[model samples]
Target: MGHQQNALHVKDLNVAVKTPKGMLPLVQNLHLELKPGKILGLAGESGSGKTVTCMALLQLLNPKTMSVKGSIQLHGRELTDLNQKKMRSVLGRDIGFIMQNPMNAFTPVYTIGNQFVETIRSHTVLTKKQAVDLAITSMEKMNLPEPSKLMKKYPFQLSGGMLQRVMIAISMCLRPSVVIADEPTTALDVTNQLQVLRELDRLRTECGTSILLISHDLGVISELADDVAVMRNGRIIETADVFQLFDHPKQEYTKQLLQARPALLLNDQLKRRVI
Candidate 1:
């Protein structure tokens, strides 16, 4: 067992949406652990509460619509009940997120360079020129084709793939100890996805960051995860090492999920052939 130190620990998490009808539980008894320098993938289809769970960890869920009950510890520090200011300190500094929708990553009026500089300066005492240089450098590291030109334009000026790379650069810039990536490659082509995946692997090797990867695609999990959790109806039906979960899934639900995955059509077809 790799048994690296856990950067994030979640226990018995319960989450509910407070609709006019009543408190409707969306997730129940959800638990997970993410170790530093390792990737933990949460695989599930829509309505599985994958996104909700990540929001809860950052304590970013809309207060009026939802409530979360759980013990979340980040680097041994309890994060379940933190004030907004403290939470902000932790968010950009210790934990960063690669949101599913990169289009919403930038303000319409602000140049990407301006926003990137602001984001950097918010977390550190770096000067405007310094932040701008850092932002361009980070974008270059994320493999953007023309970081200088792209930074001069607004969010609307870039393509979806370009925006995704920019978002990745922003999220991983500070080398946050924990990173939560939700469908990060949803908009990218296969080649770009592979590049991003390779960069993500480099992040772990370089920073020892713990990554919580949420994707509907099993292929992403297979590529990046050190551990795998199969989630259904907001619950984890199976948790195991990446290889074990893929090779020998124990739960019926997990098996069904893998079989249903469009990416595994070959395996699903072969299983029927053998049977």
Candidate 2:
């Protein structure tokens, strides 16, 4: 219904990949939730199953090799067992994805506009003109420079930051109720990162979009997360309100993450070194 009741719920989730060695378990008890208009930061080290957990949430895992077992419910709808046809409808219409590598999400052969247009046509019966207008609106919402110029360019033609913005534009253009972002700022510099984060904050506030933001950057989580889940060795060790997770971390792993954050308030020695 709201933040009080989970918008998305995961219960006793376990995931494994069949590899040459054996069935390598990746995630366990990986419970998480995303409430409407809230940012739920999912953080972990490399290979901690942060990415895999998100994939499992929507039943997007490659069933050929990866095996997942869990209960994932969005707005009380169980997704794991949804048939292929049904899941596709639910995915783009109600769920959106912003991948860690934006380039990987787009084709180098097509202009940004082409892909956006196609995506809308696939989901809803909107005219090409209508879809383009929606695409432009989404681009403007991300505060991209010269949105028209961006639409003309191919994914390879744009810089990483610009491409990442384009990816966000395309994903949100459909106005999905839920958006799962995997390191949306991975390729950005500090200035661009801050800009994107600000726009993302606006989206959460303006659209009431429930966000599952996955990142290894604790600083990003500290800035935007309403709630957080910390992962280690394929399992979540801490789940708490954003402030509590950062300020009063319960687990040793979480404490270590806080300590490793670069000291923002420079000491005399550190300042002298910088100067």
Q: Which stretches of candidate 2 lie over 4 Å from their true place?
A: 1-4, 263-275
Error (Å) of candidate 1 at residue 64 is: 2.2
Model 1 residue 69 CA deviation in Å: 0.7
Q: Report how far residue 99 has shifted in candidate 1, in Å.
A: 0.7
Among these predictions, the greatest lDDT belongs to 1
Give candidate 2's TM-score: 0.92
Candidate 1 residues 1-275, lDDT tens each? 26554799999999999988999988899989998778999999888989999899999988889989989999879898888889998997899899888887788999999888888999999988888889989999887878889889999988787788898899888879999998888778766666667778778877888899999888767778999998898899889998899889999887877777656543344334322
Instruction: State each model's C-alpha RMSD to the native.
Output: 4.8, 4.5
What is the C-alpha local distance difference test score of each model? 0.85, 0.83
